[model samples]
Target: MTSPADLIINWDVARSTASRLVPPGPSLSPAAAAREVADVRQAAAEAVGYVHTITGLSAAEGLGEDQRDVLVVDRPGWSAANTESFRKLLRPALDAVAEKKPQLVSEGSSAQVFGSAAAGAELGGILAFLSANVLGQFDPFHSSEHAPGGRLMLVAPNIVEIAKQLNVDRSDFRLWVCLHEQTHRVQFAAAPWLRDHLMSSISTLSSSTLGRADGLPQRIVEAVKSLRQEMGQQKVSDQHDAAAGVPARNRLLEVLQTPEDREIMSHLTAVMSLLEGHANVVMDAVDDSIVPTVKTIRRRFEQRGKNRSPLEKIVRKLLQLDVKAAQYRDGQKFVGHIVETIGMERFNTIWDSPEHLPSEEELHNPDTWIERMGYTPKG
Candidate 1:
């Protein structure tokens, strides 16, 4: 572990702060909660086999049993685990900074202590906001003393709450959520190298972005202030801008990214688009014969997003979740187009190597990718 004196973010502080700030999930009796946990775990296990059948990607080939473990956790557990992953993922960048500027991380330095606390609170707040929204996640960077490699997490309370809000069949919804997350697990398990590739890309981007640490404190403060103002503003809605009541640019992206950072971000977003879209495709690929209520689940899910409270909508926009929502839509279209064009077997070739992955432009223009891959369109 990096010494406290040399760290930029105090992860312990982040975890505790998130725990304090995250709202309690829907109330459940002890027995009901216990049953929900069992049902979720079973659904996750069931999903693994279905994902393999639909996507033809298998984790059994390379992943260890522990790596394949599925966990059911509440919002707090999700926040704490993700904070630890964030720390690990960003460690390389932090280490480089510490090595280059020893004085900035000097032991017991008041500036360092305050900066770490502020950064922790900032990150913790973000996580707290997100905890309520995420249903499930397949974390590739997951590792621990007890388990190493990838793990799938189901936010039990989030799942229960969303299902109730959608008024969908609880059993069907649990499997539906797991299907999406399991596809992610299969994707990484099938391509073990992908984890390293992503880790390297993130580390490089982080190092480049955080290299200066100039006015780091002021930047953090302004960002938190801006975010609070945006989240707290009652007027912001999906149909209206936060301040001007006009279509607005994603200010969060603009503030955080330089040109070089944007380039990296573009690549990362394209990759995420592919992954998320592919998972979505798998979700719908399974016929109603399997999930029974798949169509209703999707319809209600989309409607729920459209009907979110104004505050929820604004928070999502500020956090760039609106961008993620676009990723799922655009990505699914791209995947659907490719599959229909070349068939799923041929489309599977996209997973053969990093070079085969579509660029952001290619995601919008599928034929370009087909042409680049040396495929001719059929009548």
Candidate 2:
């Protein structure tokens, strides 16, 4: 076991071998960068050091190996221009969910939620391309926090470009994704079973220390380039043979989820779907009040189809979890129906306790959503 003192923060572990995730802010001359640093200091003092600063989005290679804990990055390149579009896609959902759980924004008497749970400082950063190195896979992240356990990692999602790909305007979509990551932080803080379930599942698959390796095999690189070439000419089909890609990883996930893990994963996925779904519902409800200029910016990626990463395609091929376009539709429909059946206020009240959320059985049936609430909705 690598001791805390010996755990080396290797730059190779960063998403790209060439660099580290940079902090926000434009490229600066030494003098200009100095002034920006001062501003960062001022912001840090106001918060509990929850947020960190970065120079570029790619400086992940530069992180201190010894550094650990939840880091909320206050980026330098932040722009209303960049974020505004997503607000449109996400406003309806955010507004509705907010209406559902008003106290979440308030109710300070209870504990606060962590911004994210990550294996490293980088888990939540915005990624033009996602990778296990950056967003630590749930199947592998684990530890014994009980004994100086670094088992739990808190991370925040910095998904600036996600809505652009989805082909939806940003307003609501960005906020909702943020909320989903935020949901993890919330789940970790509020649901003890959640942390256990996630960590246990991760540990069962691999170990506490699945650090990044040096590089991919040369053959795999050649293979991937070859595949991309062939793919341009051929429509993907079952016979298209993705297994030909190099560095092929085992998709079955060796560690099977225990009944406890399954229960937790199902609920967590459902809660995430609900959280995101509710955000969409909220957006649709109060969309009349949504700002105008924000609507002008179209970040449209919603209907573009499933995230088409090689890893995603591989998983779908292996597990047949097609992740329908309507996957989220059910959640949206479920929440909307609930709000229509019971008044929004009553619909919102269920979030007061975890028990009020639906079970897997309910998640399966859009029509049975209200029935799962153990009562028919009041027309």
Candidate 3:
């Protein structure tokens, strides 16, 4: 008795209802971000094997066709049509890699490998969005290896969004972003174990949360509200500083969540730094001929990010604790200091494994990392 149009209407209503419960992002407190991040990671980890079997592009394709698992994702910055083009290009590249690298195939959907050969292979997957953000810059790469079976994932930014954000032509944005994406691909390919280490670390935290998170988000949101009020129209930067009036903020958060959760958060932050840091490095290495816009692109974009946020705050309030644009400025400074002192090559070691990734101590105190490496923080 139900018409297709009626079905469509029902679906729309359902989706709207569902979204009401979900945060719109950018405004999410660290707690909410962690919750979503964990859910996504869990789904991907669970589906890895099944996706591989379906795709026929397993790590052992060179020796024999592998029916291993694959990672499933929604394309980050693409249309259905654009997605087809990316798949056409990427599938062949991955197929070729599979032909050569039998060691990286997915074992089962859970990132569980059947054998050791496939265990340490470079793992890559894509998640896409169709918004106005730069491709590689907006895209997030979680780890260099997949655990249970080592794997890595890099979500590409929507071409549409990246071009829009960069305020140049889409082609120009792609030209610059491609370096970061390729850099990620190359590093993960070279060190497959890196992906595994990161994935396992993430899983440990995520699974633990799911086990004990029955009333979590509800509880965490309340604490986040208190923290936000303490932040009280203060710029975002003020809240993150230790000297900020916010009390037991971090510690209060941990009381509700598990250490594994904190570790995952730290690991992911390190992953983002590893990625953004390298993109800066490699773009610097390449001749300007490859992309004339490379030099001024990052700075121009950062300025836009800062200046644009008050408007963006309207959007942020829908999902996250409202923080002023200053938080990102602090984040950039943090990232810049790492790049200045470690040199891109060494700053990148964070991507190599969980062990190498900077700790909370390191994020707050780069001096510790510098001391350990016998390198002082660069001015």
Candidate 4:
């Protein structure tokens, strides 16, 4: 059996490459850095307190605790942290690939070495793109060695850069960002089962996909054919439209082939949509008295998404970040619709178990989930 660490050779190269690709933000003086860190820490704590009360979910019940430390890091630090997290998350799948290596390659062959290099390079490029864009992430897989359990990470530089670009008040914007991330912290903390559920889904999907390597070539061919057919149907003017031109059935979907994989992916999508949408809801629902600039911040943030440069737009499509925007919008709408129809208490029941989660279709049609859950709106 191959070790997970052996799957990606020269990960340092990936880290360095990503760091290089990320543009540097204006440097903070020593005092400024210290102050920023202090502000984020305070804001994060307050945000958590607000979320706990607003969601009506006790932190002790959800995560078995009330608070987690928040770590503020620059782009390079954030990228490095995420790279380690991804390694942990992807290890099981990588191990599955290693188990199949003998059948895929002969002893003393250099193919494994070459493949690792390519994989590492691709992983690096993807991380590089993400490091430049992600504002904050509450990593469930964060290493305890880094801190007690895993602390919430706020990418200080990215937050500062975005706030400056939007011309928003830094203090309010900082707290706003913290609120969203802190909500994620509260989510996994409060719903103790969520971390395990997400890990299981990811592990199963990865192992299933990697274990089917023998059929990968055919799957790729089919995916290419599907893409071509999709392209052929689109008008010339629509050819470059990222959202419409690219069909949802891509290489990963084609490779996973089995009904089991599809089901797993659907579950994963639904859960993520809930998590993301819930965060957005919590962030927006903050009292205007607390986050006075919330409306302006949200409006400009939406405009920022619509006003990306041509190159940035292409990069977003390639990095699958475009799907992220859809997730936010679609998920927000879904959660909002359900909550409006059945109330937050009924909507919160979806988090009770995996079965209660919405399907892809149910995400758009709240009635399906409402009916299936047998929930009736208050008279």
Question: Highest lDDT, which number?
Answer: 1
Q: Write the per-residue lDDT of candidate 1 for residues 232-322, one digit (tens) a residue.
A: 7756666445574334355554455677877777788888999999999999898788899999999999988888899998888788798
Task: Provide TM-scores for the models.
Answer: 0.86, 0.41, 0.48, 0.88
Clashes of 4: 4
Residues 67-131, model 3: lDDT tens digits: 12122122321222232332332333333443344333333323223232132111101111122
Query: Model 2: runs farther than 4 Å from truth?
Result: 1-128, 131-256, 286-288, 293-299, 303-327, 366-369, 372-374
Q: Candidate 1, which segments miss by more than 4 Å at Cα?
A: 4-6, 60-68, 144-147, 213-259
In the order shown, the candidates' Cα RMSDs to the true structure are 5.5, 17.3, 16.3, 3.4
Q: Order the candidates by lDDT, highest first — what do you get?
A: 1, 4, 3, 2
| Per-residue lDDT over 242-298 for candidate 4, one digit per residue giving the tens place of the 0 to 100 score | 544434544345443678998888777777888898889888788678888988998
Q: What tens-digit string does per-residue lDDT give for candidate 2 at 311-360?
A: 75774555434433344566677777776776555565455466777665
Candidate with the greatest TM-score versus the true structure: 4
The local distance difference test score of each candidate is: 0.82, 0.37, 0.43, 0.75
In candidate 1, residue 341 scores what lDDT?
A: 88
Q: What does the lDDT come to for candidate 2?
A: 0.37
What is the Cα root-mean-square deviation between model 2 and the actual structure?
Answer: 17.3
Q: Order of candidates by TM-score, top first? A: 4, 1, 3, 2
Say which prediction, candidate 1 or candidate 3, comes out ahead on lDDT. 1
Q: Supply the global lDDT for candidate 4.
A: 0.75
